[model samples]
Target: MSLPRIAIDAMGGDEGVRVMVEGAALARRRHDQFQFLLVGDETQIKSALESHPNMRGASEILHCEDVVGGDEQPSKALRRAKTTSMGLAVNAVKQGKAGAAVSAGNTGALMAMSKIALRTMPGIDRPALAAVMPTLEDEDVIMLDLGANTEADARNLVQFAIMGAAYSRILLGRKPRVRLLNIGTEENKGFDRLRDAAADLQAAKGLDMQFDGYVESDKINRGEVDVVVTDGFSGNIALKAIEGTARFVTDLLRSAFTSSLRSKIGFLVSRPATELLKHHLDPNNHNGAVFLGLNGVVVKSHGSANAAGVANAVEVAARLLEDDITNRIAKDLAELGEARLRETNGGAASEGTGK
Candidate 1:
């Protein structure tokens, strides 16, 4: 099959058209088969593309006169869906002109526009944002609901698990060990909804995942579980906390290394090891946060991300398109439906037989 073409919001991100276009060019180098639909002002996009000679023939520019501001409310942004650069890029996905859409624009605006344009997939109540995080283990871990829905019911939590597990399968190439994030690891711990979700996941029959009970926030990066599922409220807070902690440790190390002459020499001696650590913890390496459960793939790049980070986000979109993530999600939902049907039928039969 031919590689899918990705739609990019050229006017999005802090660096404007330059970084987005340069990122596209970088991504093209990694995946030569992929093409790009650059959506933004024609003159600016043309100027940006001029800097990357090789990207000239690989991209098609879609002129967009308007743009959604980073601070614009989702309600107001939705009204500009037909004209904004972000909106046009997402619309390309809805119209099937592009396989996926990537934007570094306003997060709220992007989410609102994507849902309105592409709609949620069947059996998914609400879409969730899933991102890969570097872990102590050899492989990165996938976490979900990073600010999509503020609150999730038991059913929503269950759906998040299924979607997360499917994503893990794509990234890890195996059935992921899924776990519900909570205050404690004990089954009896956490709120009613979390415990209830855990029970349902444990009783689930057909999913190709191992339910590993509850996992605390402290153990998330240990790589014990492949997928960590949680409501958006908690997930968003946890994500920010982890990011802050990573920054803190890195900053502390820098301070320690520059404290004195001896430390400076020590830093030079350990430069190789520190470089590896920096690479591992770099946010650019894990820049993409996918909105799973949407009918079409939509990757949200960090607003302040540089060309390398944007390229990483684009690569994520390409992977999802190639792997057909939506189809995999549908298949898993079917399994869950069948399992529920069987349970219902069995329960009715037992009641009728007075067992």
Candidate 2:
């Protein structure tokens, strides 16, 4: 069966049209059923399409010349929503011209445009930025509120957990183990919002995943937890710290290997292991970050992503569309949302949890 047509902001990435078109073509190669609405400069898109005949037959160009700058603020970018490539791609999703939108642009601008154009889904206070991060185990972890909102109440955190768990169900193909990110695993640790969110999740009946309490940042990539929920401020800081650490380790290894003749010989002996590590650590393998809880699907690709990374982002959008993720989240909300959690008292729910 054919997948939903994805709208791509072809001029949004660092390399602009060439890399975006190539990536879409690469994605179409992987899944021939995939089709696209390429939104960007008409001439540039057409020129890029010439090398990818496969894309020519499967894709259509929307011809948007205006592009959102990487440094532009969300408020400023909001004004160009009708004309900018990123805005137009998101608009295509809102207008039902495409099933999902993919962009490797200014994240704040993309988030702003998406929130305004698609709005939040019913029962969602705000949509969080969720992404797949590699873990020690084969199954990657799903983390959210990466930078969408700086603060979240207990209600929003509960909603984020629900959304993250639903996303995990899709990615993991089973009930996932969810956890709140906190300084400690103890019940009284962190603030009331953390404890309150945990309480609500524990009380909620028939949730698809297991919510066993909080997790520390050190355990995030350990593969023990499936979802890590936190406010944007904390989540974003954790994300950057993790990224910086990875870069630090890799650079350290490079410097070590080239330090002397004995080290270079050792590197040759360990080349196979290092190559495996390189592949595992490559961000291209996990390039798509989703705007969960939006009325329509929108994916954010890394601005510096190459064609392979862009292809992964496109494929991520495809998979979400195929599964009808938004409606599934809506269904989950309808069955057990704020009403169920808010109405149930803390004492009774705590007794039920036996904690």
Candidate 3:
């Protein structure tokens, strides 16, 4: 068996090189089948590796000098941040030096660089970022186009569903139930584009998966869908809403507990349950996001990710590479032919021609 190669952007996250290097070491310890290529400034990476010398020879460093800030325009950085760590890590995957790429850099910059370097699969219109989130049902739900295609058309939405479904199958080991995000479950509740995509998804062929129609935002945590698809603009908004709500509720609970002696006693009694909730909702536990529909496996981690979170993200990338996810996605997209059919049928037909 060939050992998996994962390229890590060593200087991308807020925690800096030490945490990223330690994360790679942690992942290597767990999965001995992977050899990581740590990309960053050579001097810093070497210094950090010396402090934590466990993965001593299992990892290697690829040096690059510049760094792109989160606020930099993605397109501009892709063209300009040529020697940056993010570009170097992604370039490794493009150059075949690595089986997959993992990064904790600026989300937009990472997406832009991956798209530019790896491009999209033959039948894919746009690449979507698919992230798994913990649900109230003790299982994770896959959410896609999380700021990838901000203004996607109906056809793009359908493509996101297909890509997300394939990912869910490979990673989650099941045929995911597909759902479209809408204002209501009613067939005519959303905008024209969403309604059209919902219909197209219903008529999609060659996928041995389940389509569960429209899912309202309220249904996200209720286990209503295994895979929820939407354009990046709406998906990003929904993601932020969930994050903010989780933090707000946690803070509210803490304030309530400290309000009075009686509440403090009650909180002490329920400390275990509160801790469980915190553990379950922490974004670090679900740190990886796959850039679906790309030619190569690219997993993006949160900017604020810690060492443990980076380790988990690396595991996700390694698993995707091992499962031959890129090949599977190519086969699925080629077999479906929906995207091509839409283009053939006058480019804007009311009904999808899954020809």
Models ranked on lDDT: 1, 2, 3
Q: Write the candidate numbers in order of decreasing TM-score.
A: 1, 2, 3
**If both were scored by lDDT, which would come out higher, candidate 2 or candidate 3?**
2
lDDT of each: 0.94, 0.93, 0.85
Clashing pairs in 3: none
User: Which run of 10 residues does model 1 get worst, by summed lDDT?
Assistant: 199-208
Q: Candidate 2: lDDT over CA atoms?
A: 0.93
Model 1 TM-score on a 0 to 1 scale = 0.98
lDDT string, candidate 2, 20-97, tens digits = 999999999999999999999999999999999999889988988899999999999999999999999999998989
TM-score of 3: 0.92
**Candidate 1 Cα errors over 4 Å, as ranges:** 350-355
Q: Which candidate comes out best when scored by TM-score? A: 1
TM-score of each: 0.98, 0.96, 0.92
**Candidate 1 vs candidate 2: which has greater TM-score?**
1
Report model 2's TM-score to 2 decimal places. 0.96
